[model samples]
Target: MVSETVSVSVPGNVDLAGDLEVPPSSRGVVLFAHGSGSSRHSPRNRAVAEALRRNGWGTLLMDLLTEDEERSDALSGQFRFDIELLGERTAIAVDWLAKHPSTSGLPVHVFGASTGAAAALVAAAERPDRVVSVVSRGGRPDLAGGAVGRVRVPVLLLVGGRDEHVLDLNRKAAEELPETHRVQVVPGASHLFEEPGALEQVAAAARDWFLQSAGSGPG
Candidate 1:
């Protein structure tokens, strides 16, 4: 059964911002970090949430950008380019989720799309105990640069075959990551995987990775 979605406002840079989703008696909680101007309302991330909830895993799809930041980006397009700020916001949300009653004891995983992937990796590096693993889809993980090496969590990088640019970036990021992680390029898909059946493969691959890495509670 799916637990109701609740607003667990996190103290962001300014006023609090964030939302958490928990599945009933969930095996674990996966936090979603939306990139650029996206927020908790992103359809793609929401779709992934539905899939994860069905698979018995809870989801916390938080917005990396606040309302003001979103407006600023709409005007100047700067938020997506600032990985550090995005990473900081992601870290704060993860910390909040760690303390949220509904998610406190569960394994925490961060699933990032686009630039949020870099932020997720940085958070994993910063809070190893809170974030046990990471999964990236159509992500610009390379944007995280040298931070990948510092992450203790096992990371699974997923890129679409047709998205050559992002695929190459993930390939390079994989080399920087520890040998324990895995990287896969889903066949017959683009960055958005708008193509039929492509996104399904990515979702399945990520689910397996998150479940495998979710140990018996936090380390």
Candidate 2:
């Protein structure tokens, strides 16, 4: 396997910092969209990425915001909740991956956490010709608004059983999604999935989802 730090440029002069890992004979690549107030260095997301790499899948974990923007949002908490902006950034990253030589030609999937899941759904809607599948970990898919209904690709929504409100929201969002959607609740886990085996379950579920959905064709 090979791992490297990459810089991806999007529109509006924004440059995203990311960690890309490609395993030998990788079947596809999964782009990670972190939730509000998080970044590419999120430990939980990194763990999941490691699991995917072990499963022979490439992974890209990128920060959706620039340093200056993150600093500004740290005080006002404004951009963190801006799902449209986040979705646009995610779409740009998808395009970047499509054009990047090393990752191009590989089926693309998205793994989103929290609000990032909303952005992932929106990106899936926007790039139906690229994104093959999407998985949300403790995500707020309801925040995707009408974009949720437009996501034709298979989607897996993983929620913590202990997180009642979020689970309810996932259920509601599933109603608007295609029949290929699924909602899995990990028992004893909260929003963070900090329980002993909770995160492992999440990684396993995500790995299986991406593997199963790979080469199924575009969204």
* TM-score per candidate, chains pooled: 0.92, 0.98
Where is model 1 poorest over a 10-residue stretch in terms of lDDT?
8-17
Worst ten in a row by lDDT for model 2: 210-219
- Tens digits of per-residue lDDT for model 1, 74-94: 999988878887787778878
Clashes of 1: 0
Instruction: Tell me the alpha-carbon RMSD of every candidate.
Output: 2.0, 0.9
Question: What's the CA error at residue 97 for candidate 1, in Å?
Answer: 1.1
Global fold similarity of model 1 (TM-score): 0.92
Instruction: Give me the overall lDDT of model 1.
Output: 0.80
Candidate 2: deviation at residue 98, Å? 1.0
Clashing pairs in 1: none
- Compared with the true structure, all predictions reach lDDT values of 0.80, 0.93
